[model samples]
Target: MVAKKREWRSGRRSVATKLVQMTRHLVVCEGTETEPRYFGGMKDALGPANGRKIAVVVRGSGRHTLDLFEHAEELCRIAPDPYNHVWLIFDKDDFPSNEFDLVERKCGEVSSSSCTFHALYSNPCFEIWPLLHLRYTTAPMDASSCQKGLVDALKREFNVEYRKNMDGLFSLVDSRRQDAISNVDKLDKHHKSIGNDRPSTMNPSTRVGDIFEELGPYLDKGD
Candidate 1:
């Protein structure tokens, strides 16, 4: 028996709806000034394709390690969909080591199935990231020493004094950003080699370069 073919109405064709996916990053930092400025520069410098595809939004949470982590986690839970990358950029600056460990563990536990938290922590101080752009340093410093070193490095390299905030700080360091990333890798490796991989103990290590690499395509190539 031959089956009859169904008749087509006209020449019209059906099309499937396409869902566009956009990548957005929500950043919460412990600093009130510089972190926002730095990430803002990155967002502003995004190239066209990246600007359309990704977003790097930063907020200053003014919280310590665990508090900052919780703030980022809370924001991730409340933010609308497509804001999947939630990062807490905090320093281990004299905060209790237990708090640092707790923050790290909580951030680690968040899976990507839902919005997740990224702990972009710098041991000692956040200023260590900019200092890495100037030179390779594996020196273990306390918060005071870290601040002093950063101030001296900034003065020597860029002729700018270390203020609590610097306007366009990321752009200032953009030319040598790759160098910073490389140096940070070396620092991280050094820490791991010495078995100081944990947060409070990873003195002089910064996760800033890792975050920068994630958002690099969005930023313009600066000379």
Candidate 2:
């Protein structure tokens, strides 16, 4: 949203203007529990924004693919304040390739000067994100296979059980946040090299780290 025009009485008008320029982000996820819980923990960990420069809101839609994209659009449409960025987070899963790819295409169509929509997807499932923290693998996997991989990785690496709705899941793997981001980038390049540019065809890959990359500078350091 554009800042209101103001007549400043104090010498700190520039500082006040900076506060009004705060960027707001809306993250809409497909899963009702797991995705929301993981991202919610990240929001908490980010704490308060410095000088109110950034604000993040995370919501779970209990929807998938194109439906999740529509839900995100509606949320932004009805939001009291306009969001500077809207992120649609979902899984490639077994959704038809055409439908899976449509969301990313629609993101471009719906974007404008005021807000930009991004389709950040995980191939197979969201569990791939957590699994990346422990180790990186380019092997293609389906939903069940990805979940099994995560379970094995968690048990082997941290001696912890992987639960679908586990609390503090973010904190459990926060230490390796950078590693996960790096691995995701590597996986992305691997897919590109193999001519697998479509989101639906990029197995065992995720763009979830893109959100973290954008928000890294605004994260609260006190935590």
Candidate with best lDDT: 2
Clashes of each: 1, 0
How accurate locally is residue 216 in candidate 1, as Cα lDDT from 0 to 100? 70
lDDT of 2 by residue, 1-223 (tens): 9987664754435554333578899999998899889988888877756326677898989898888988898898899999989998899888898998899899999999989999988898999999999899999989998999999999998899988988888989988988998899899899999999888889988888888767876553552
CA RMSD per model (angstroms): 4.0, 6.3
Model 1 scores worst on lDDT over the 10 consecutive residues at 4-13
lDDT of 2: 0.86
Q: Rate the local accuracy (lDDT) of all candidates.
A: 0.79, 0.86
Which sections of candidate 2 miss by over 4 Å? 1-20, 220-223
Per-residue error at 108 for model 2, in Å? 1.4
TM-score of every candidate: 0.86, 0.88
Which candidate's TM-score is highest?
2
Q: Model 1: what TM-score?
A: 0.86
